[model samples]
Target: MATSSICRRRSLSPRRHLTTSPASFILLPLFSKKRTMWCYQNDRCKDNFKKSFRLLKGCASERLSALVVVLLLAIVSYTLYEVQYKTGIEIVPFLPIDDSGFETYNEKLLNDVVTSKAAQNQLPRGSLMCWVMTTSIYHKTRVNAVNSTWLPRCDSSHILTNSPRFLDDQIPYHTVFNSLPESYYKLFWKTRLALLYVYQNVSSEFDWYFKADDDTYVIVDNLRKYLARFDPEKPYFIGYRLKRRMPNNGYNAGGSGYAMSRAAMRIFAEKLFHDKSLCPYHEWEDYAIARCLASMNIYPLDSRDELGRQRFLPWRPEQHFHADLTPSFLMDPIQFWGPSIFHENLVSMHHLKPDEMRLIDGLLYGVSQGIWKPQKAPNSSTSLVNSTEASPMEDTIQPPTVSF
Candidate 1:
């Protein structure tokens, strides 16, 4: 039995050896890895790789968020700097060109008014003939104002300009020169040309030649009353006198209005045509006229009220009434009308702008006809107390010192 068992054991041992050999080879690596702790190490390496990748991604997202916030702040700061202290551009109004074909007239409109007045015979023609030194811009409005209000009272009326339009019959465009004067300096030539025209055309037609700017408003009735005493035959030149420089022989303030008698016009015309040097060109047209008259020893007549105030207002009414002229009761129309003396006897109003000119015509007309009365006096306050109360003769006849 021992022998038989030994043979069987020996046979099984060979088979078991063959199977164990292959199994041992496979299990040998697993046993070696467990001994070295390689399984735990591999697991740790994968976990560390995943954690590193997540941290890097989180850092990149934070950096991108900070960059976006900084960009927004930079954009807001620049916008505030521009708004605080920058000067903006200025916008100006457009002035239209005032020229149409020269020597045109609104005759149909003029004839309707003139003939209607003549038919009514409400306005009797006076001996004074008025002329306005006007331009293209003032024709429709300014000239029309004179025509509707005061010009009808005069025996004859005319406008002298470079290019006459809207009233061909009344406005005589002096085509003597190439063009009309547009600037203040050019007025010297303009006045020169006007004087020549007056000399040639209408020197003998009227007793007095009244000259004024288109902006000036004249109370024709009051003017007639004022000149009733003065003879037209005498060499009379009357207006607001200005003698700003030495040898202050007064010259009429052109804007305030002036009147030259027929005798004076004749003399001026003769001297201007015959002796050109006597009436030389000047920067100011009024100054040039004064120079011409001064050469002939004819000075401007003083036109002032008995109270020594100027009848011709060279400046606006508002200028005379201010804080400087205190004791404001005199200017208060509510105080008294009789003592409200500044413009009570006012004849010619000057320095009127286009809009103001349109409104003042009716006011002046109403005042002249006793329909509207002045309630307030002007503030004739001066730096020197005595100057405000000076005599009319002294104030008007004396040399005036003015700056250009």
Candidate 2:
């Protein structure tokens, strides 16, 4: 009985110890609060770090992209600038060299020509007169030939003068030595003369001007008549169409005839004067003209008939006309010589031989006589001749056959 009582007391003592422990309750609540606070702080720090990392990454990407774009734009701009400023070099003969020095005759001539001369020179009304300037070597054979044949046939009013020569005897040794490929030196002299002519004379006297080779044959009347049909108020540059596939560097099949408007001439002349270094010394005159025109946004015009045939195609022998050789008949010939029929009627016919001239004259006389003598109704063949007035396609008519 005594052992049992001791065990019961021990059990009751354990129950008493549980009921009296207040320190355990306080310490548990404090520990739980501290744990929850630590967890909350750690989560806040993690979220803030993630947001800062994303913002930094976004800023860095945008900056890198902007830098790349700027670099690319800078490279393209520099390349284009270089191309515009670069000048090409070549070799050609210089002009206007005299015993004293470079001939100042061109300057004198330009100064002498007043604005009144241009207005009264039989040029078309409200149209620009362009004087194409060229200098020949003036050798005895060439001068005599030009004087006797070309000048008379073309009926040029300007006189031939020996004011310039294209030799380099007067140039210093250092200049010759520094100018390698020698051809470039000659070309430089020629270009300089041409530019000087433009600066001193062409800009003031004419609305536009062309510089070309002496061998080129121009039907001035035809050119003038054609251009007369178009409105001249807008910016325009016309030249023969070239059929090559390459870009601007190929040979121009259109020959050397190039046209520019008054605006283009003024702009080009101004730019060339200030930036003389931009001129390239080259053999291809047409290319040089084209490049210059392109800088000012000018282009060449295409030549096509109403039926879509090229105007300059090889001529068939079957097509000929009596009136084709006469001036009062077709208006298309006016494109070249402005308002002057003298050039087309008299001068152009001079190139033909005596026999050819006689044939044309006889045809005109016969046609005139036939029309005057005949009395025909509207249905008759003779009336057809009268009905056919001057037309643009007059050059395409077949002529009557005559046995020699």
Candidate 3:
């Protein structure tokens, strides 16, 4: 009904203009008019074309913008799906190696480290000092399990913590960094500050520094045996090496724990942590430290055994044991890692509960030792077969080692 009224008004308006004006009556026969939709005037035709083109252009721009947004969202979603952190998964941050603008390394640098290992001694006597990360919340639970099981095996061990009772407790808890609030986010600062404390106070007393999470269980003797293969005087950051892209190379997983040779500890404790330009404050403690180390040409060292079995595992025993994906995911599981979860003489396993910690200790020390003692064969070398003093599990004897 409204359209009929509009049509009636439109039809009458042209007739009304014609009847009212003698100019329109004379001009109506010319066939071209400026205001009419079908006008063939050059200016009117050009204006109409411009308006139509603008409308079409606006519509196309909107469609293109929507298409771009959808494509961007899809790309981001797929990237997130690929890099999402799962239980015991190694998180690969989408950080370009040049973002830090630190030193870059090549294959030769890694080759040198491997070659240097050949000149080092096996099972050398070295003082291993371990520091564990803990908060007030884990003090009674995970800390106690750590102390009872593996902490004693270290030549000396200190608990790096934020407990209010740091000095009041009889345990050798280091509290130089107790000033910070006990927050997980602040663990990065806690980790760096803890290293500073060890550097200042007791670094001279140890040959190697092993840092671990409180929930991690360490086969300290196996760790000692592993570390003995590298020169303590040379800088080494040894752990479960996560394969990041170029320049970044790799970094030790913070959860599984890592060993720093005395030289590496000294480098970090004395210089790297102080220089924010080289090691800027990052939310990730491991990556920040890694960047600092890499700036000085001290990249992560492969802590795998000769047969390519992993020594430091980021996941707990079951999590690693039942893993289905390769660490890097570009290769088959067996090709990337070994056929099994990890080396039999694994240095550390992380993400354990308080009960699991005690359970692992019992299994390695009591159950396995009691059930599977391998007697020294007549032809066996060094003769420390199934020796508890040698390790919780007997590592195959190295050459030139005499009986204890």
For every model shown, what is its TM-score relative to the native structure? Answer: 0.53, 0.37, 0.58
**Residue 105 shift from truth in candidate 3, angstroms:** 30
Off by over 4 Å in 2: 1-196, 202-205, 208-212, 231-233, 243-256, 276-279, 308-404
The predictions' CA RMSDs to the true structure, in order, are 29.7, 28.1, 18.1
lDDT per residue (tens digit) for residues 1-404 in model 3: 34444434534677543433333435655654544434335464556455545544555576688799999988976665444422112344452222221222111122221111211211233479787878777767777788778887887777766544522344556544445665544556677776766655545557898899988999998998888878889999988776543234677888889988889988887778667667654546676677778888998886767776778778657656666434562111333333475556788888988878887787888676764444443434444565335442354432222111
Order of quality (lDDT):
3, 1, 2
Residue by residue across 154-218, what tens digits does model 2's lDDT show? Answer: 21222212232431222100111121123422433344444454434433344444332333333
Write model 1 residue lDDT over 1-404, tens digit each, in one string. 34334435534675332223333334446557563345235655445445534544555566677789998876754343332212111122232222121122111212222112222232223478776777767667776666566666666666665454554444333323225447765666666666656545544656777888888877777777787778887888888777643134657777778888877888887664345458654555676687788788888876776666666655455544332223321212222223243465777777666556545655555544554433344345654455555444444432222211
The candidate maximizing lDDT is: 3
Q: Model 2's lDDT to the true fold?
A: 0.38
Candidate 1 ranges with C-alpha deviation above 4 Å: 1-126, 166-178, 321-342, 364-404
Q: In model 3, what is the error at residue 348, expressed in angstroms?
A: 0.6
